[model samples]
Target chain A: MSTTSTTAPSRTSRTSRPRRRLARFGSTGFIAALPFLAPALVAYLVFVVAPALESVRLSFFEWSGFQGAPQVFVGLQNYVRIFTHDPVFWTALSNTVIWVILSLVIPVGLGLVMALALNRKIFGRNLFRSVFYIPGVLAPIAIANMWRWMYNPNYGIGVNLAQLFNLPWLADVQWLGDKNLALYSIFAAFVWQIAGTNMVLFLAGLQGVSPDHVEAAKLDGANRWQVFRNVVMPSLRPTTVVVVVLTIINSIKVFDLIVGMTGGGPAQQTQVLALWSFQQSFNNHEYGSGNAIATVLLVITLIIVVPYMVWTAKQEKNS
Target chain B: MTVTAIPTAAAPVANPSPKRKPRPLSRGRDWVRVGLWVALLFSVLIWAVPLIFMVFTSLKSEADIFGTPAFVPPWAPEWGNYVEALDRGHLLTAGGNSLIVAIIKVPVGLFISAAAAFALSRIRFKRQRLLMGVIALGAMVPIQVAIAPLFQVINGLNLLSTNLGLILPYIAFGLPYQTFILYGFFRQIPEEIDESARIDGAGNWRLFLTIILPLAKPALAALFILDFVATWNEYSIALALLQSQDSWTIPLALQGFQSQFTSSYGPLNAFTIMSVFPVLIVYLMFQRYFVEGAFAGAVKG
Candidate 1:
């Protein structure tokens, strides 16, 4: 085996050296990588990349998704209609913005508070951590369903508790049914479902904080809040960036909960970009218009996500 | 590497010095600790209420579900709700479908993504960074953006509503994050190992399979759990693609069951509990790896 191994390289070197040199443009390394990458690349291209590009292409055309139907090129008309003519589009966009802001603040804020509270050597820290994180692990559909039932006007906890407490005004309030309250109610559910994830992430970040720095700050007369603000927060910059970016992306892609809980109901009050895109394309059969909304959503998401991705890649490379 | 380093730095703070006597100020701190405990307990109870309600409602008969307070335990637990969910709600079949999808998709997707990640991390090629960036960006591409064209593509291939259809996209969409994580892992492995293997007349394929793959078992396991949970809980693609009842996953089936049994909270809650139980078990079993993998993917990617 040793002899064959020894001779194999010499023989190949002598005969194949020139060819290998010539194959630099398509080296053995690159060639070998093809089989490794082909399956994922082909699938990603066909299912992800091509479809993304097709969505962009379809945005400029009017088509009902009928097989063999001609796609009429309408040259920005879809965009124009979405921007100027559609009231629902504005509501969805504004709601999406609200979602983005709420997801940014509430989950991040609560997660930070929980992380801080749980950071020290506390009793049942592990139990609390696990319990808090359970919601995040469950399916969003399940969470939404649970909350939907909780928000049920007739048999819901909200109404029943309100009635038990003799708060008639609170008892009669429609949580998911009212246009003004549906989106915020769903946002609250979203926060409950996701805050655990943020907590866990922040805990991980907290673990990385230099305890010595915190101790030093304390020794220098820094109070609890000051120590946290001065020592812990700066060290958690990386985690904070990650949490914020992920929350934004998750907020923008909010669909499952809306679909499960509200279905963008009460005059499309809860309609976000994603749900609206789905409704327009699949439900309304306005393929072009739907694709346009999807394209807008894509652009908006890319605008935020791409830069962060680039930043992450660069950070990883540097480290 | 860095993950290990961070914990070591924090370890000393966890254990106070035994030589130091307890001070009077420590009594004050005890009250603060109590406050913290109270706050944590309150949060835990609040966090658990919805799930507790789910279990309570699932255990009750239809009459009790509406009759009793949401928090009250059932006098006689309706174990038949689970049976009804399985039989009437088609949850077992949907669960089987979910299992099949996850079982097939997770490992297959991991292998494919690991392979691609191996290429990106180990192989010297032009356009490597650009390709990596593109794949990373793919992680952020919302499924809504691709659903329209992807649906059309699946229809064109006549794969829509089939498990294969769902599996394909799950694998595809799962690739970016899996590849990103695996690539980070692969980069951490020393290059000398690959060099020695190459010197021993091992090619790239053998080197990857024999050396690098084994070395990456932790990462593989982490991604395995993460990807499995994701695939199992995936909603949008399954909803859009798997239109037929037989092809529905747990989430899709749960949604359908809820819609069908709008008034019956017992079976609906039972179905909900059943669907989330496996994922919860997996998360609990691998809590360390799950949390680490989750944060690592986001923070280190």
Candidate 2:
């Protein structure tokens, strides 16, 4: 490579001395970058990128995850089974959609309201901010476990509250054990864990809103609701975009909480796409179908995320 | 029409330019402030309830846990619950495993990512944007999609149930965001510093080690705390890879402990509290950096 570079410099010298120097600089820069890039590149390719691509390839084959097992190339049969015949796949997909909607609506709405409220120069402002954000930092496993016991029928806070108020009908609601209420029950816990993150993000965005504009709108005889809707909401669009996209991504990746709280139980009612994939691949050992579900999740995620990411990169470049 | 007419009649009285204060307006504002305070208090209680309950339950004896009203504070704060958890729940060993993973992975992962970020941001290469784009895209790819094949790869390499198994993937998965964040910081450093260092006959390696890293210390610290918390709390990869009880991280151990001691709420809460305490401390100590790091990628994206 050095020999080639030396010979090329001689050929390029006829063009211009500065041009030849610039070419040398570029080449040297590339060479210097190679060693620095190697470690992360190699690990990312082998562990992250390669495995992702391999999942796509594995989705086309049938394998049961046994030692000495042969992989059978089955074409699009796995996809066909998931889309056309499987009931659980449909259930998981629909539940994932519900999870996405719940995440998008409840958390984002609550966060926006809280951000608006906390945007005021209230007493204990920082204390309230920290208190709300504490749950966001705790492990989902720990949060799920804590909430799981909180939903316990016999001695849980939920039932106890119902009984304390003489609400006999609510006492035996069976938060996690009822198939009808299980998914929403887990979602309530999830919202408790995640709403704070959205709130903080919105709070940051709210802080960025120009006080001058808000005052100007109020001076123009705008009511409080009108001021918030016209001025504050528009200013928070970027944060809303971020919160919505992140919530969607997080909703799709919901696994640990479900594993901890319900184990996709109460008759597989709360099964999500990611958890179903785990069950299929690891528990059932049906690698082909599992990979197919994973592929579907990846495709769905990228369809929403890739364009946004590219746009963000372009915005960063322009800035 | 009367409503509009009344407001117009009162407009002059309410619209003082610079001299007089509006008593009704101040009274209304005070009410809103009081309402906001009430809402803020409610939000705090909602967020703190589970944590408060966890602490209270952890301190309760078994009889107290089963017998007392759920809202009542533990009559006797059983410090022995923590001892029982440590002795029987495997919390100590699992915590050590988590600490080891975080210790080994965070610094090493930060170095590799920072080096790559330096290359992408500081070094003038032709395909630097493309490389950065690839890494950015890689950040969005969920680990769930790669779990099956990654499991096979780790198992094939005979690294399953080992610290290396968790560390390798943790670093790999952590690199993209770390690189992106460090790239932002690295780009903020003036190129003239590098030029002067080069003029002093310092090589690229020496310049990075001596000048660039020290300058990037804040970013490094932020990523350190963020990555440490994330690695310590990681569950999916650890669950899929670590099979043995002895090799389990805190999350895995907690799951196993929960299942085994399904009815032992006191010890379970103790285990939960112990596992989350380190992260809580780090977060409280570095609150500003923690929030900044969390928002860096999202706001930038």
Candidate 3:
């Protein structure tokens, strides 16, 4: 066996030099990549991976933040309370779903339409693209603050239009104050800011479709609607999937717009899971419950995100 | 790679004729096209109207903001709001904080993400594929979800309220996405170069730095700019970590200002306008790169 192992290399290359070279190559790669690999591994493990696991551990504890020596482990009590006992938790989660659906449905729908329009060799296409995409490029703080005024109820256009048209906006029915309208209003601001991103993605997807197919469809007497439905939609599936995933993730994580516009208020109508998590951790100092909520979100995210990622990777492998 | 086929028809006609008579607007395509342009222009106007209102409100007096029916402010606009918002120190300090965070974050984030992406993409190992999948899934985890435990870790490390502390967490949260994008770009690079580099006695570090990094400049630039913008505008983590007024970044300061100026629309609007310009300038300056980068980092992958 030893003789055969030694002779295998000699049979192929007739020398020990290439074996040494291969060994050197392998070692060199390992050594060279260590610097790059170590920092990322350490930082991510220390800050991300460890904390995530620790959060799951902490979710079982009852503790106040920064004022205690240690926390008491309560074992599923935190999760139990969040699910059954807490009104705010359910409200926050429902609001998140509401925001996600509204924001995703509108922005993605409009984006696909816009992408179809802009994908053509239309005049002033750049101008139109820029106008739509500007909101995306601007800082979130800027978009949020600007929209706060735009929704200002009195001097703002929304309120002004309602009043001028003899419909009371801020006076009779508070858009930001009403529970039903507040979440929807927040969703509107979010859609306005992020629609451009989806549009850009869809535009990229639309451009990926060859013009010949489109022209051929036209020659076959396929109407614009038919061509779009049959030819355009199927080709754009991956992009749609990506857009959907990103929109869902973005919707789930939305915080700045809610904080800037509503502060989760008139009476917790617009409170989302993210803001709720933050409020629990920082405002209420209930670190355990907060961490519990965070852990739940992480698990939920995995349930959605993992399958999609694996599916994409599998698609890539197959392709 | 979908192939298209040409339809066979008559080779030539005695007199080539243009086909029309399907739709009324087909005869005057120019006018219909013009109408489409007008409709597009109107939709754009709808998008811009709110921005214009914000600008006008910023320039108007508090009283004028309500009283004036004038879409365009009458006479010389009141620019006092800009002065007042600045004097309040919210915009100035917060802008400075955001700038500091962004500047530090860009290089740090780029190096880490690039290195990690390089290893993940190029290194063939048993665990590489699994690690890549993990990080991609990590990208989808909400930052808010991580906030609680992160606060626990940060407070334990005594990093609360310090810029470094805030910056550390931001970098951590940003890595999964940044690395995911960069990994895709890195993988697209041909393997021949790395083989050739190894043959030339170039070490992996030397090869990565000299060959791969130079080739990955566009991807790196795109990642750097995105990290900058995201870190710049980030609020939730910053809000939670930064409790002190002085340590506050622009988004937090804007939140603080929002409460203070809840009654006065002028200064609030002015501050909002002012707050956006730094980010605007960055975006415009790298507008070409931003557009191309969006496609490269996003579309292909």
Candidate 4:
């Protein structure tokens, strides 16, 4: 190892191990952060950053996917094919959009209402919070299996419970069978698992609402709804951002639950980009087209994620 | 394995949550209070029904499943379902595989995350916020975008279908969230400790090991349990990486196990019930920290 820096002789004469001065290169000083940064930086670059970059590259190239088959660069052909020829792409894109839109509505709608309901100093608040949140801790596959069993056509709980309760109309409704209803049915199960998450976040936000502000509003001729609207809602904007961003991102990448539930079935009406990306590559061996869908998914995510990160960076600077 | 976005908004800065009590109702006005209670219970019942059905169904015989109504509990508890699940599903083996993956991934992941966090926090460097922003964005990026290429990379490394292959990517994916959490934590530790330690001739490594890490114990503990649960429940990377059934983690194995017992959901439900215990035990024991972890992990897609 040689100290190639021209000024190293002066620094080295001051101390045997002039660590900070000796390690300086390219207008930077401090060597301490390097050892600590190396493992994580190297691993992340190789495994995550490099592969993620490859996914974009793979989108532009076609390969036969055989033993040592050479990949041929085919610039926008994969994207053009997906846009022009693939109807499933439209269904998946629409389904994913619906999934993202409803995720902001149903589950989190239930979440907001529940959070407001539970924000009081009620008895059993902890119990109720745990009840709603426990489903989230279970694996998505487990949740899928649980919901699938309940949706069974003949002996499902929907049928049996309808029978026991003497409701004839509810017994024959196919939850996961019909094409139009399958995506929504999966969303229902998704709500069962996710509503609690939104609730907890809202609850955190609610707790942060200064009690003094609520009291001052109460003192000035405000009702409960008025105080909530004026005082509580404004303070909760940050938490709501976290909750909404979390929902959109999670909704977009949802694959395991869909995979376990329908496998994009019933004539492939329920395919989302995440599962489509996986199936196109692994199942159909169309690596090029799969990467194209994945890149679309990546761009969709970046649009949302980038702004949120910028906001957090701003927050960090201030904090 | 724990995933989340940058949580500057809800890092739980140890706030003292002061509850606001509702005005006490007098006499006939009690209907308002009563109505609130009714709404609460009704909503709870709706939420609890599916879980209640799972518990009830797990304890019934195959004959009783069709014989009885869906809501009823078993007249006599049937432990046989659990036995068949444990005995035949080779679930114990899958359980071991899951545990092994968690055991390896959690500590290794935590070390890198904490070290990276330490560098980002304590060590002076330019582009710290840029690096921090990159990590925060990485934490939020959907893992699906990295899937196909990650598979190719693993194949190239000759580690396809191995637990190491599964966990290496798992660790890489885990770093962003864990580092983000620990970075928030490490920033909160006072600077005086670092100042005095350096005067005592302590180097960065010694200061980190002896002083800073000890002060960050609570954060580390919270991260520890959260990371464990996340690793234990992770599905996607395992799906893309762990192809062989022999190396399948719990979630992957559950999907495989379900196909075998499609006719008899008895063993399948039993296995699902059994699988919940480890997660349930840890969750219940550390319920307080989990709320934080859950909030912290909310951004995980």
TM of chain B, each: 0.90, 0.86, 0.88, 0.86
**Tell me, what's the RMSD of every candidate?**
6.1, 9.3, 7.2, 7.8
What's the alpha carbon RMSD for model 3?
A: 7.2
Winner of 1 and 3 under TM-score: 1
lDDT of 2 by residue, B201-248 (tens): 776677778999988775686678768888989999998999988999
Could you give candidate 1's per-residue lDDT for residues B100-208 as a string of tens digits? 9899999999999989999998777778878988987888878899899899999989998898999999999989978987888888887667666766777678888
Taking all chains together, each candidate's TM-score versus the true structure is: 0.91, 0.89, 0.89, 0.89
CA-based DockQ, model 4: 0.42
Residue A195's lDDT within candidate 4 is 94
Q: Candidate 4 lDDT, tens digit per residue, B1-301?
A: 1222224324434445635444475544557757887889888988997788777888889998878887778888777999988877867777898898899999989888888988888776778878977876777778888898999889899998888898889889889888887887787776656666776767778878898888877667667776787788888888888877788888877888787788676667888888877888987986654453344443221
TM-score for the second chain in candidate 3?
0.88
Residue B137, candidate 4: alpha-carbon lDDT:
73
Candidate 1 stretches with Cα past 4 Å from truth are: A1-29, A313-319, B1-21, B291-299
List clashing residue pairs in candidate 1. Answer: none
Cα lDDT of model 3 by residue, A153-203, tens digit: 655666667666777644455667677788887677777788877887787
lDDT per residue, candidate 1, A37-124, as tens digits?
9998999999999999999999999999888989999999999999999999999999999999989999999988888887667667
Residue B45 accuracy (lDDT) in model 4? 86
**Model 4: runs farther than 4 Å from truth?**
A1-30, A64-67, B1-30, B291-301
Instruction: Show pairs that collide, candidate 4.
Output: none
In Å, residue A225's CA in model 2 sits off its true spot by 2.9
Candidate number 1, chain A TM-score: 0.89
lDDT of every predicted structure (CA atoms): 0.84, 0.84, 0.76, 0.80
Which candidate gets the maximum TM-score versus the true structure?
A: 1
